[model samples]
Target: MIAYLIGNIKDKYEDFVILETNGIGYEIFIPFPFDENYIKIYIFEHIKEDCYDLYGFLTFKDKEIFKKLISINGVGPRTACQMIKTYGIDQLINYIILEDTKSLSQIIGIGPKISKRIVLELKDIFLKKYSQNIYSTYKYDAVLALMALGYSKLDSQNSVNNIFLPNDTTEDIIKKALQILAQKV
Candidate 1:
């Protein structure tokens, strides 16, 4: 029932952190590394027959993604956390929407089959918002231009992934993508 926590981190482990609040130390499993000694984190508590665990995230988006992932038949909290840790929220959503199972399967415990299943199950639910916002108008236009220039979808995607910064225009993205593609050639 612990929904959130704001405390000083007393210790850190490879897969978890010990957060002390009001003199009580609570062990919270985390998906990624955190260097801060003080943190305010959202939490998800999973209680089962022999296990009661708390998983923490710095953002609500991550918590929601974790919840969605663990709801899948073959995915558990740990697996879901690993997924977020590996690809991060933005890249993971893009991979799912694009049905790029090869990249998705690159994570340690994920295989081709699971990656496909993840895409099949979550793409429709998340694709629209992510596609519209994350890609942005100019970046999307740049991808289309790359496609028109004969780049394969995957090549174009890799060329421009997260390459746009604030205020970058279509021309800027196209230039960057071409530069990346040229380096690969």
Candidate 2:
């Protein structure tokens, strides 16, 4: 299996990129856009009797998340890509942890049933395998508060995570995050 590719981006399309490595060009599907011409993409190769596809992620964590998503019975690589593209990693983790099927269903290809299944199936795995700090009630509450104040979920989660410290209350985290966000503007 091809673990990863390090090369220059020969071309880019809506959902895939052509990377040239060692004089060979490989078409790899991506979940999000890449601005950098040179990159090292962790790869996931899907092979069946007649189908072969390459899915690439910027980080190992992203590759692992993609693998986890595709492990579900009905979720395929494309659906997993769509999920990541729509919600991103942190927000998707938050949605799953909160069991918010409605938000998950808002993705283009995901419906209510699949959203519920995604939550039901991945919640425990995420709780067990991923960072326990992000699953804390205080952090979750802080992220929600930031979102309520009109911040994007990804930005809110990132800010909160960056400012969080042990023994700090949700209010403290939110206040610090707001200050950090203010400076960024």
Candidate 3:
């Protein structure tokens, strides 16, 4: 198994990113937190029925958490990514600690039944490695904007909270959330 890859970013696509190390380009699954600091990443490869998928995480803890997430009965990589995208690792940790299955289900692709299962199975694993410092600094102003525009807090939270990779700042979050929210009106 490949442990990790440290390289320069050769190119980035919409879903996958190409990292060049020693003249080889490794395309890894693009996590939302892949930014300037994540050009070099540790990867976990999962062999499936028809394909091998490489999931990337900037930290070993994150990779471990990802592994635990996918280990849930029905939680797949996509759902795990969706979970991280929506509430991030801290909120996920918080939710797990609080047993907030409702919040977990709010993540795209994670239903209540599956979320309850996740809370039951993986909560202990994630809380042990959860980092509050990183996610505490994480702030999203977009949700506030959506709330200001008369959208429900949960809706706004879910909308701006579910942005894809290429992690944006509070300002960027607001801009993109507005663009997405505009589609509704």
Model 3 ranges off by over 4 Å: 127-185
TM-score of each: 0.73, 0.75, 0.65
Can you tell me which runs of candidate 2 are displaced by over 4 Å?
131-185
For model 1, the superposed segments whose C-alpha errors exceed 4 Å read 133-185
In model 3, where is the ten-residue run with the lowest total lDDT?
Answer: 131-140
Give the per-residue lDDT of model 2 (tens digit) for 50-156: 99999999999999999988887778999999989887887778788768899988877788888888889999888777645454767889999999999999999
Rank ordering of all candidates by lDDT, starting from the highest: 2, 1, 3
RMSD to the true structure for each prediction, in A, is 7.4, 5.6, 10.8
Better of 1 and 3 by TM-score: 1
lDDT for each residue of candidate 1 in 1-185, tens digit (9 for 90 to 100)? 78799999998998899999999999999997778999998999999999999999998888888898887777889888888888787777877776889988887777888888888998888875566544565577789999999998888877887577756777988999899998888
RMSD, candidate 1, Å: 7.4
Which scores greater on lDDT, model 1 or model 2?
A: 2
Best by lDDT: 2
